[model samples]
Target chain A: MSSFFLFVLTTLTVLMLVYLYRVVRGPTAFDRVLGLNGISTKAIVLLVVIGTTFDRVDMFVDISTGYALLNLVGALAIAKFLEERGEERQ
Target chain B: MTFEFPLLVLLIMTAAGAIVVKDLISAVFILGSYSFALALVWALLGAVDVAFVEAVVGAGLATVFFLLTLFRMAEKDTQIRRPPVPWIAFVALPLLAILLLYGAGDLPAFGDPLSPASTHISPEYLENSVEQTRTPNTVTAVLMDYRALDTLVETIVIFTAGIACALILRRGT
Candidate 1:
């Protein structure tokens, strides 16, 4: 059962790497943001994996909740920055 | 050991691949994948609580937020090749990696009987953790009860990160 979870986790990581490649090599700034968003989602799952590893979930639950909040704020901030940049270009 | 070895190898390969990938968006996803792999390894090591946090933070919200940011970014020419950063930073990273790997050398085996972690608190917790806290999950008990102040402090730090991001974005205008 644990091994199955590990395999699933690995496959997800591989998928995330593909996304990261898009972020790093993609021509557009928007692509990178997309990749970053993918990474954050992966992080949440990663947190769950951690909680499972230690057999205690409350700490990780709080951390994951906090992480989600941070990720949302960060995305908004980046979007705002890019929008401002676009305006500046005009 | 068989299970652990393959996972570690996969982790190293993906990390290397993420660094070498030229596409920015792909790179971000690769980072996500790296985090996922890490979470798996964390779980196999018997740190279920940490694994849970990693899965939620590393695989879920972080990836979504990153994509949202990407959506608002301006398009650029693809012919520009890889993004540039200082070579010195790249050089320094390997040294850090080597140090981290070196630190792992002396550690106990995964799930081994004599691990310091297993020996450290299990006996005590087995005896008193449930009795004192009335919780079946010892890890949760420890976090919410035995060391709640620390957890609260950590939460505040996360809150501060949010505030900092808001200030940086808002004040720039």
Candidate 2:
């Protein structure tokens, strides 16, 4: 079971590399923001997996819940900034 | 160990890309990705408490702060340029990297039972944490109970940072 979780973790890390490509060569800020969002979502899952592996799912779940909220805050903040930036440009 | 090496490399790559990217917004987003990768690495290292903190502050608050800074700066100021390669940076960076790598070689292997950290205070903390603090999570117990003063001081420092940022950002033409 741990090995299966470890496999999932490895797969997620590889997916992060794909997201990294989007961040590095993104054509626009929006693309980078989306990539960041994807990475954060994956990280939340990874946190859960880590907790399960350690047999501390309840504790890790609390952390991940906070993480999800913060992720939302970060994404909203960036979106707001870009919206303001666009207004300024116009 | 097998998991750690690749994650570390990814962290380095994302951090480097964050600095190297041309656009400020893209750089900020990439920096978030870098933080996320680092949090994963910390979780894998069996430091879930640190990992949680990193996820919140590194991936969350720090990215927002970076974006806010970018937005506040004038448009021209945000255009990060690839400056003429500084001779000092070139020479210094490689030396620093080599020094760090050499240092890593001397550190105890990952999760080694005889490592200094595992053999020292860790056992005492683990064995007595529940009895002392009645908290299942020793990390929390240590921070909030055993070392409450330290946590208080850190909270004050973070409060100060928030105030400083607000003051600086509020000052304007």
Best by lDDT: 2
lDDT of 1 by residue, A20-83 (tens): 5666666766677777678668767766665665566765666667667766766676667567
Cα lDDT tens digits, model 2, B112-157, are: 8899999999899999999988988787788899899999999999
Number of residue pairs clashing in candidate 2, backbone atoms closer than 3 angstroms, sequence gap of 3 or more or interchain: 0
| Docking quality category of candidate 1 according to DockQ thresholds | incorrect
Q: Model 2 residue B74 lDDT? A: 84
Candidate 2 Cα deviation (angstroms), residue B170? 4.0
Error of 2 at B35 (Å): 1.1
Cα-based lDDT for every prediction? 0.67, 0.83
User: By TM-score, who's the top model here?
Assistant: 2
Q: TM-score, each model?
A: 0.56, 0.89
Compared with the true structure, what per-residue lDDT tens digits does model 1 show for residues B97-146? Answer: 99999999888875666888888887787679898999876777888888
DockQ of predicted candidate 1: 0.17
What is candidate 2's lDDT per residue for A2-78, written digit by digit as tens? 67877877888888899889888888788888888888888888788778888888877877888789888888988
